[model samples]
Target: MARSLLAGHRLQHELESAVDIVSRASRMAREIQKRYCDATQTVGDATTLAKADASPVTIADLAVQALILGELHMLFPEDRFVAEETSSSVQDERMEGAIRTWLTQYSTRGVDERVRDSIDLGSDAGGCRGRIWVLDPVDGTKGFLRNQQFCIALALLVDGLAELGVLGCPNLSAAQEAERIASGYTEGIEGEKCLTIVNGTDGCVFFAARGAGAYMQSLTDRREQALPQQIHVNANTDPSWAVMAESVESGHSSHSLTGKMIRILGIRQRLGVDSQCKYGLLSRGEACVFLRFPRPGYVENIWDHAAGTVVLTEAGGRVTDALGGELDFSHGRKLPNVRGIVATNGHMHPAVLAAVKHVLAEDVTSG
Candidate 1:
């Protein structure tokens, strides 16, 4: 049965609002991204928006968190949000000014006061509670900085499970997607551009409501004229035939171990992108395997995984920690109990899980 949103509100209404807020957030982010990279824009301008050590990408992260969380506060009113950025994290005036500028368009509250109070609305720590929204307003800062594949992810968690999810990826190519689906490698995109019907940039959005099924649509389309397509995990039972997805950043996982697992399983054709775009790839049947084995002692953040988990889960994919345990979200902001994450199309899970275990056993023996 499909789940209703907060207070018996239809899931459809919440889904609609979530999609709109995320869509607009995507537009805002990509536009900020474009301007950040513009040749005409002075380095000083980007410097002004930097977080620490002059990383300009922090601007987009702060801006998106502020707007989306603020909008969520307005629409849902009574719900809670656990988000990445907060008003206190705005350490510099440049960060504060940039966030305030974006909030100005949507907020009637004074810029400074709105900036402080509004962003704080997202700082709630989650629990097994009434309704909690998990948001990663900017899922991959590295990808966003380079104009590569970054995603904006949001989900509503009720009773410790993600009931609704939306992912906005503004860099993946639709034409390349079709070509790559046909042949693992397509004729390269010259100048590196995606064939997307762009709103602000070439991108796509994937969403799901539990039991209702997962779907994808163009990043820019409005509901009235949108061409949403239902999606599912690919039916590839053989690990040797799998196309795997992983993080683009080498530091994000223990690649050496993952490579051993892939080699043992005879899997080929790994596609790595930043952020939850990996989940979007899987839910749309583009890739079948994803692994995240962060360095020891680092607890996985819930905001990073909740949205993708629901989209993939509804699309017939299975997500769990490296040990094949369920990802429990009832605890708090960090998934302290989870060692790492592994997601795959359901058919390949057992085989993949065995390979992961085999590799871990070897790691223990070697250590």
Candidate 2:
């Protein structure tokens, strides 16, 4: 009994520390967006470049990563980390200076070495043996640039299974969302209308522990709502009335395949957004399903879905590959074993899985 109590205490302490670190990182990202990503600009004024995979990397990505990893190092120096952004992505002197400027907001350490070391802390190769912290400093950069939906995702994996997850959706309005849900406005609501009507504000932080359920709080809440409102997936079991959520970027997922699956399942309402905010929406029962069938040969990164997966599952939702395989995150930083991603409120997961297989099988036969 003593051992069990001690273990529970330790888990609670770790979760509290994680929430603090992620909240600080989220605030820093919001500041950067306000400064650089205004209405006049599509992409933030921050310097941008392409990675080896041809994906966009911006100053906020590096800065938020540095802030989160740096804080984690201070809190738990022994833990390993895997993240998406790297110091090498910052090439020019001006960009380096921009990163340095952001670093000063978080710490008083030396600018040059601090920035590089903090970002490089994420270079560790993760495996199934010990504790690892996975981070996506800024997921959905295109959404961030356009001032749309984007998130700062963080997760802790113990022995390769996600035990804690935190996501900061800068465009999500928690108070408004609760009001909408309470009013039974779950269908035929435009995504933009949801954003504008509910608080006209951005910023919500959702988090979960392995066994404990998922919960959310507003970033702008100065008083820190004493107890976060617990969240759960929708209870609707009928497939015909389900609402689907997918990425707004067609390049990230196969639109044709998703369309076919939607039709097959008789889903009529669809919401499109950028980032793992889809997972946030699902957790709060704002959407019933999330489907992402990445293009052929595109491997899903662990950081992209790890935090979101835990958040959804803890909120009475289920996530797996399109073929119903568990997402394998033990190999390294990438989910080499996952072919595609599917998420839904628990009730409809099996039905959704059937539709996924049917659509893919049709593709195989037609090809």
Best by TM-score: 2
lDDT of 1 by residue, 1-367 (tens): 1122222545777887787778777777787777674434343254234445443446677778888877778778999989877665677776677677776764443344466676677788898877999999889876676566688999998877788999977765432254332222212212222221122244677888888888777765554434567789999977655777777666777766777777778785666667998888888887889988878787898989999999999899999988899988888888877877899988889988998999989988998
Task: Please give, for residues 1-367, the per-residue lDDT of candidate 2 as tens digits.
Answer: 1122224654676677677667767777777877777665456445567889787778889988887888788878799999998889978778878877777775533334567788999998998989999999999887777666789999999999998889988767776343232222223332222111122374788888878788887777566542467789999877666768787677888667887887788786666777998999999988899999888788888999999999999999999998888786788999986877999998899988999999999998998
| TM agreement with the true structure for every prediction | 0.85, 0.88
Q: Which residue ranges in model 2 land beyond 4 Å of their true spot?
A: 1-8, 39-41, 44-46, 107-113, 176-200, 224-227
Reference-based TM-score, model 1: 0.85
All candidates' lDDT scores? 0.74, 0.78
Q: Clashing pairs in model 2?
A: 170-203
Which ten contiguous residues of candidate 1 have the minimum total lDDT? 189-198
For candidate 2, the per-residue lDDT at 109 reads 33
